[model samples]
Target: MKTNFDFLMPSVNFFGPGVIEKIGDRAKMLNMKKPLIVTDAFLEKVENGPVAQTLTSLEAAGVDYVVFNGVEPNPKVRNIQAAKKLYLESGCDSIITVGGGSAHDTGKGTGIILTNGDDITTLAGIETLENPLPPLMAVNTTAGTGSELTRHCVITNEETHLKFVVVSWRNIPLVSFNDPLLMLDVPAKLTAATGMDAFVQAIEPYVSTNRNPITDGQCLQAIKLIEGSLREAVANGHNVEARTAMVEAEMLAGMAFNNADLGYVHAMAHQLGGQYDAPHGVCCALLLPVVEEFNIISDPERFKELAVAMGENVDGLSTRDAAELAIKAMRQMADDVGIPRSIKAIGAKPEDFELMAENALKDGNAFSNPRKATKAQIVELFQKAYDAE
Candidate 1:
């Protein structure tokens, strides 16, 4: 309920089919003549990736550019350094990221180092980036990550397994593309995982310390869109309307979490991603219900909204009972989506729990959790996550 607040997003956004055509025009407006298109090698070969379209548009606009498609999922620090080297060598003045969060983050991490000299490690934490990163545009392929609009990038340190969140106002893309058509060829498993990622964003922000009226509206609406459409998108991948709803859900969730921040699910999931190389959304799906159940004791009332947004009917249950019901609903959703219930099932070792918990407690997102946790408590949460449910 703070009277003063702040919001972050792309200065311009394009939603719906065929909006990718304006990508070159947007780059021209940014005074970007030579743009570097960042993406992964796999996506570069895929039918739906924006590499071809982006190249076509940039060429038509008479913009000079180079393609650097060596990025990988759970992208690493070296990826940024390599892209930065290419950007410098090719004389690219701007960047266009044309895949998922990995591509978007690679562009951002590279752009930061490109303008600010080198030693990419200097831009590690929040606002450590003092120099303005080159103008960047994010043309997102996946509906999740919301990286297209958010000013946060999770770049892993290859040697340390540390997931550094580079949060700066400068990281927000100049414009974002959410054309559902780009998402048409996404496989069902990934569709489910990223969709749940959006769901967690909305749910976590509802109870974050920084929650405000504006973010509240966005989070709840995003949650509803996800609960309604994520399954449809997963079951019938070609359902354009469902895909459209899912894209909206991801977009709204980005708007919500970008400003309000997130909760323990993301904090713990970050550790899993940095440590075990787990899919970000799969780790979130495993941790979401566990964290919710652990957190409900602190704010049972909040789960009322959580339950409703997750599509649970709270007819006559007590707040505590309804909270448990919400947890059940989330667990069911995870099961339905084929997400494994435990870290052990997903190849995580029980011995790793203590260190993972240790790292999880220190994640900045944990600072905003409604139920503040100690290291020992996080260890307990990890133990629960270790045993396959």
Candidate 2:
């Protein structure tokens, strides 16, 4: 942690039901003549999905775009290469990403490769990019991951079977949109996973070693909002109030972690995502409780605060007891939202735990964990998460 720190976010952000409607005008304001639209195949195929809506907005604003919808659930290095190729060949001057983390990260990685170098692997660490990215706008469809407004991008290497994070202030999108209306049709399981991802994002930052007062307030408020609305949003995706609340919560959590950094949950989850090709949010949900349990002794008072933020009734309890309630609350909330309890459910094997643990310790997010974990302890956490029930 530094005595002096900088707070960062996109210069322009719009949040509301129909805020996506301004994508075209926003792009024009940024002077985007022809932008490459990066997204996943599912969104491209949906008749009225996020990509289609973005296209409608762009066309209405007379902005031309070429679409690359090959992004995977966990975007690979090749995905960035492909997107960058498309951007150059199509004569695009800007980039617009639709959907969540995968799409947004693909766009960010492409931007980095375009200006800094042709290879993205060399730019994996913090503050490695020497050049500013081309104009980029992230129109977020999901309320999870917060890639839309963050300075982080995660890309998987196919050959090594590992995920690497790219952290740079330059990776922040020039504009961001969080429209709850766009999230109304998300599948129940996905909604649950994403909402829990947001929860972990909040909890991890609040307890992070690098946390400052601004991020602490953001994380706690996000925790409270998620506790109040995530369940309803998962149970009934059409619930506008719940959906809107989740959008706010996810954005706040994103902003919090963007500044405060994250912890072991993200570090370990990245390994699982790269190893098994599991859903990122599901990996986070399964690992969060186990890692936080290990982290409780680092800051029991903070855990007690988290308990209250999660709506746990910890009145008159000892700090340690209240902190234990926080863990229980996490378990119950995950259960209520249909998150699986074990990494075993996602195909993570014991034989792979040692390597995953080693890789996790090297992850950028691991440095800020409230507890400095040894490789042995990380492996133990993986085993505990795998055997959880």
Candidate 3:
């Protein structure tokens, strides 16, 4: 156990059902009289969607706001630029983001540019920001990403077709709302993908080189919660109890990875997400078992502990055997949630593996991978993920 480690999360977290309704008051408390609401066009148009609920709360609180519903999945630098333009034009005093990771990330990027006055791309790496970002609040509608609680934001470069990660404590949301009710309407496939993303978040940190006792506890608890509830959440999206559990699991996993950082699963997945414009969770789900399989050789005991955390019965099993069981459990959970069996099914081509592998090696998350991987080894891992069943 490390004698010293840092733990951080949003200062104010409103969790559970009906908590979103207090967004107006929360904004007021933060002294955000005028705010820019960053979200996706889908959420803005969906009848009675989470965006509408957020708007209603803001109106009731007499808060003035402008909406920028241009964020896209795997949000790009252009998205932040456009949102920052809107923020400046509206004279918004603060920022509020609604929906999932894309929206939160876009809001974070905009907040960074708003204060730092730099191209979003310039602030891509860890602790690159010279100034603290403007106050931003995140209202999460997905039980995944945990972007609301974490200080990391991922943005894709359209020109390079590569994703860049930004890690800074200044990017953490000032306030966050996680209401399972808002997640009830998410489609089953999205629910499954996002749930698996949360699962990867928990598992990867458990085996990360940065793992500490505090993050280990959070990851283990999140693993148990996801194991018990993810399938239910995906199979029955309207199940409030299951959804609530999944959200809690995601938040815990976020806290774990937010501090310990992630590993190759995220590092590799980021490349696929940037290249194919794929769903982040689906990319994570497809790559997780493969990356962990490669990683198990580095920390068999930790992998065995992960198996126990995921509810695999490894009694009387050798460390290697128990570690393998963790991979099996991860595959089974992903299958139960209907994730595609291979990355090839999600539009990744065999020829792109080399370039993706090269980029994966450059990703910030790769530094924390339990095992160091050469470019050829990363290419092999991508090939394995592509052919995985």
lDDT of 2: 0.93
Q: Can you write out model 2's per-residue Cα lDDT over 1-389, one digit (the tens) per residue?
A: 44577899999999998988899999999999999999998999999878899999999999999999989999999998999888999999999999988899999999999999987888888999999999999999887899999999999999999999999999999999999999999999999988999999999999988899899999999999999999999989999999999999999999999999999999999999999999999999999889999999998999999999888899899999999999999999999999989898999899999999999999999999989989999999999998898
lDDT (10s digit) by residue, model 3, range 1-389: 45588889998999999998999998988999899999998999988789999999999999999999999999999999999888888899899999999999999999888888767777777888889888899999999999999999899999999999989999999999999999998999999989999999999888888889999999999999999998998888999999999999999999999999999999999999999999999999999989999998998999999999888899999999999999999999999999987999879998999999999988989999999999999999999987876
Q: What's the lDDT for all of these models?
A: 0.85, 0.93, 0.92
Cα RMSDs of all predictions? 1.4, 1.0, 0.9
TM-score of each: 0.97, 0.98, 0.98
Candidate 1 per-residue C-alpha lDDT over 1-389 given as tens digits, one digit per residue, 9 for 90 to 100: 44589888888999998888888877887889888899988778865357888777877787888999988888898999999889889988889999888899999989887777676665665677778889899999888889899988888887988687878888999899888988888999999888888888888888888889999999889888887888889998899999999899899999988899888899889888888777888889999989988888877888877888788989898888888888898888888878889887557776777887787777768878989888888888878887646
Clashing pairs in 2: none
lDDT-wise, the better of 2 and 3 is 2
**How does residue 361 of candidate 2 score in lDDT?**
96
lDDT of 2 at 221: 94
Choose 1 or 2, whichever is better by lDDT: 2
Q: Is 1 or 2 the stronger prediction by TM-score?
A: 2
Cα lDDT of candidate 1 equals 0.85
